[model samples]
Target: MENLESENTPNPRNPKKPKVVIVMGATGAGKSKLAIDLASYFPIEIINADSMQVYKGLDVLTNKVPLEEQKGVPHHLMGIISPNVEFTSKDFRDSAIQIIDDIISRNRLPVIVGGTNYYIQALVSPFLFDDLIEEMDDCCLKESIGDKELEYKFASGNDNCNVDYQRLKEIDPDAANRIHPNDFRKINQYLGLYARSGLLPSKLFQGQKWGRTDNFKYDCCFVCVDASLHVLDHYVEERVDCMINAGLLHEVYDIYSLNADYTRGLRQAIGVREFEDFLGFYLDKDYNADTERIILSTEDKMSKENLKALLESDNIPHKDLLMESINRLKANTKRLVRRQKRMLNRLQALFGWDLHYVDSTESLLGNSYDSWPRQVVEPSVDLIRSFLHEDNCTVPTKIPNAVASQILDKRDLWTQHVCEPCGNRILRGAYEWEQHKKGRGHRKRMLSLKKSKQYLVDKEAEAVT
Candidate 1:
């Protein structure tokens, strides 16, 4: 699959304005396909919301859309991590906002697509890690050490290191019930935050009310791609088969050779454990083979024989085994899809209800006219009207040229910083800016820019200040 450079197209429908289009669905539900299709119609760039697809060397297993399939639509946040690296929903939320802003700045629609519901919700709602961090600070929270420290502090060298579990039960019973006793990471985060801050993390999280319309400017239209369970199962089965055919086993083998821990998030990804089992079984059969001749046989021959034998074997019956596995997978997939659909419905309902609730509250207080629109909207409209004459609406008058110039300059600077190179402003201190400058393409551009008189003067002036 060839990666194509993304071309920017100005959206004439909403000229000089940006919009966000969020595409959400469960895994194997064709989110990427739909996003690509949407991009074909709109001036949009796709931002991945899937947590698993972000890791490098997990394309086939994670079902990441190939570069060729993206149809030259720019995709962000895919393959951003090594298989061995760690990532979180918080990280995704932070990265996605920046990508969305960048896309908007380029006069393109920001299309967020993936099945990771938490990540999507975090983006649409105010419930973010930054908010959690603020809560932690307000409550005077401190970080907790590893399980060992948690055990020592709580139990004071008791035989049972389950003291952390007991403490969680005492502080936040609901969280304790949901969290497994052995889930050290979650238990530690909960217990540590509570112990240091005197406020339960769960309670702090639960207290924050959401579903306010004033949060975002965009007209959000959530489109759910619905499919029957039978159809979804067929899709998953076909996708799994494709992954296997696309050297998924080989990829798993390569990853296994890296000697990374399987318990970590990357290895714990779907299909990794199953593929690892397949590899182990293959190796064990070769180990138990009787003859040196068999051991010396070609890999193709070994694989063919194994495949034939497995296909022919009556032990555990391949049909029944596959049917059973597929049924289980289908059931789980259906449950997840149903949950996602429910979430979407809830969000839509909440949005509608919130609007009604606000209106009702205003009416009840006898301040129906003193709404947010009165305070913010009328002034903005007046400003816009005053700035633009009826016939000569070429430019806004109230908005100063200097301010407009600065805005345009900042936009240009951001574009240059995010673009190929040479036009970047170093003082912005964006991480992507640094990466852009160090890139090979950017370095070549810098070389060309250095030869230009105006570029050299700008560089010299930048350096002098």
Candidate 2:
């Protein structure tokens, strides 16, 4: 095995934008491992960008790098926030900037590792809506005609979200049509911004140059750790099973609340929401004292085995529900992995992100200790090394003509499609709209509509004859 090391020590404090290395990928792609491996060669700190992992608990469920696995590297923003607080991208950007600055001052390379691409996007791009809003002076924001009345109506409206959305459409059709109608927070934000700035939110957004390479806040070397779909599916299922064995259920049980909101904070994590049904049923069941004791006992392998035996003996239906929730957790996580991969591709193509690819399919599938460093880690370290030492301050990966030809057009990228045939599901961007059209449900809906139309036409012809 080669002694992996960073060839060039970066003087990020000098003229060019302070360099930051971003490791992003789908779940179970080993992004965290790759980032941590950089520590062997460079003085590095890991800044976790995983949305779920930032919450205070659910370590097993979130698959946070166990402290031992982190290789004694300083990791920031992992399990630090209150699980109840809805941490926004703005919060991440603000916190990350401070951390990045601090890391640079200390001359340690900051390696951002996670599956949450939006958080990475917020950090790199300057056109974040919140960031833009913060720059405007209070005096520059004045009340326009009917602004107060519109605000009052929206504030006092009887939960009529449609009315507020309609008002947004009247004022800024482009903005209103770009977002989902049910996204009340976004609708409210658009309305408020328009009222304060005396301009359409869409208009205000113009010339912000979102996703433009030139507008990046830092010299970032983006590395995407990827694997084949089959490999990822297999790996994710195994990971979920491993998490369950590692007391994932116990963590979920710890936070199980009858009225917990799944859309908020840590509850939004895949594992936590899936077990709600089973946990709800288990609590309501009239189990024996021994079974209850086993359930409440420390969640170890023995306790799990005892609980399983007890459930099997009692002929309780809870076992099936438990299995169902576990299956759901696995399925949802796989879907999430696919979505994350798609977003990374979109970032590369539409947003012109120069993502250096690291294929971990072999390492993941074979589970070879040697192949991981040789194939994945060595390439990544080389890329980061070149990025730091090179005059361009970037890894020299050429953008393909296909991606380069993709014009940086936010209007097209943000174009919204409401698939009425598919229950009026809102899909943002042309890529998502295309994907939605290719879905089985959408095709089935389209076929049903066609058959209904043909039936009506035939009946009308018969009546005419």
Candidate 3:
């Protein structure tokens, strides 16, 4: 319910160090536009903090700023890495800090913006990697290194430990289950943390000072672009429609031809992998990462009529498939938005005074400042200017209970299952899940599962007889 609130923290904006503005928001909350609009008020270059946007290609799925929309403002870290390479949060922190320093040297502002909560959190806060990397440098902390040089010490870390994802599960099941079994890099990190430091990765991470990491020390403020849940849901659908209109299918197909691994890097982008079923349905896939993934059916050779008939014969409606992709994408995006809201709340709880909130509900469809009323936009811009020009600025800090309740005590929300026979609605909590099980729809699924099992058993018996 509070309007234009900010937190006053210990961070003092020094003239020597460059001022950085971090824009935090969910997928469709217009973060990019806000960062660009700040250029009108101050000299600013954007440093992208989104994980997917770090990779090259699949721009549509990443919601990258198209050339026309960039408005000639210089941006860094967007569409820069190969899709096949695994880019981690530590890599982002190191690279972004260097870039921020460089921008400050040139007397220009560096603004960190995007949807990846972890990436933004790492860059804006005291990151776990800073401690880990520093500890690695200190031969005193790690006995296994035993006076060995920094570069050579961790050279054979994986081989020496022979640790894998399973070991991580034994040590830290909570962290392991959240990560994919195939994410060996993170698994190794967790394993290394435990082996060298005698600390759980999860505990080390939580115990670190959030938002004020020692290595990445820059005077910064967080501007969160937020909206009502209903409004964000609407914008997500609109953005998806725009992506569809902008040839998202062809974009994914283009990356597919590159044989990018979905389990790693940019190919893991939401829209890219979600359309795999549709792409696999239409096109022949020889998509091995080590080999070329060429499209066998060229547009010139494959007639629309022929493709339609083949899918029809297979009982797969092209229109229906597209709709299903759209719907699934919407669901995933909305879930992401919800998670983002909660993560931002974490920032508020930790860095209470440094975070600021800007209501973007009204500015959904238009450019940043122009879309907002003069009253709101002017003061907001002034607040930012004061941060940039002055040492510190004071603004009211407010956290609505409604926002806090949105994410409180809901760790298992994502793991909850939906009742497929009961309209496939998501069960968000244990109570909802229990209620669904007791409801007619869940009972129907139970009956269906039972019947299917019985039918299989009967068929086997008949074969034996």
Better of 1 and 2 by TM-score: 2
| Clashing pairs for predicted structure model 1, backbone only | none
Candidate with the larger lDDT of 1 and 3: 3
How does model 2 fare in lDDT? Answer: 0.79
Best by lDDT: 2
TM-score of each: 0.58, 0.82, 0.71
Question: Which ranges in model 1 have alpha carbons more than 4 Å from their true place?
Answer: 1-18, 129-131, 134-163, 180-182, 210-219, 257-263, 285-335, 345-465
Report how far residue 457 has shifted in candidate 1, in Å: 96
lDDT of 1 by residue, 1-465 (tens): 111122223356644323455666555555566667655346668888887888887677677888888899999989978777667777787788888778767767677878776777777666664566446545423444245335535553344437777877887776665555766656766765665556666566545544433454343434444444455656666666666567665566556522345655678666655444444444423432354222323543334224324434674544344334434544555566656655554444333211101011221233566543443223323322322222122223333445544433332111122253455433222323554566676788877766796877989999999
Candidate RMSDs in Å, in order, are 25.4, 5.8, 8.8
How many pairs of residues in model 2 come into backbone collision? 0
Best by TM-score: 2
Tens digit per residue, CA lDDT, model 3, 1-465 = 111113222225523334578887887877888888777777778999899998998788888898889888899999999888888887898799899877766667788998887787666666556457566656555876444333333543545333466677787766665566677666766666666666666766645555532334666766777788898998899888888777676676566534346778877778776766765665643455555545464543443335324423654565567567778998899989987886675556434425677777867755565656453345567678767656664555575544433434332322446566667765544544665577665787889989999999999999999
Model 2, range 401-450, lDDT digits (tens) per residue? 45465545432655677898878888877777877788888999999999
Q: Which 10 consecutive residues of model 2 have the lowest summed lDDT?
A: 1-10
lDDT of 2 at 74: 97
Off by over 4 Å in 3: 1-18, 130-134, 137-165, 172-183, 212-216, 257-260, 284-316, 351-353, 365-370, 373-376, 400-465
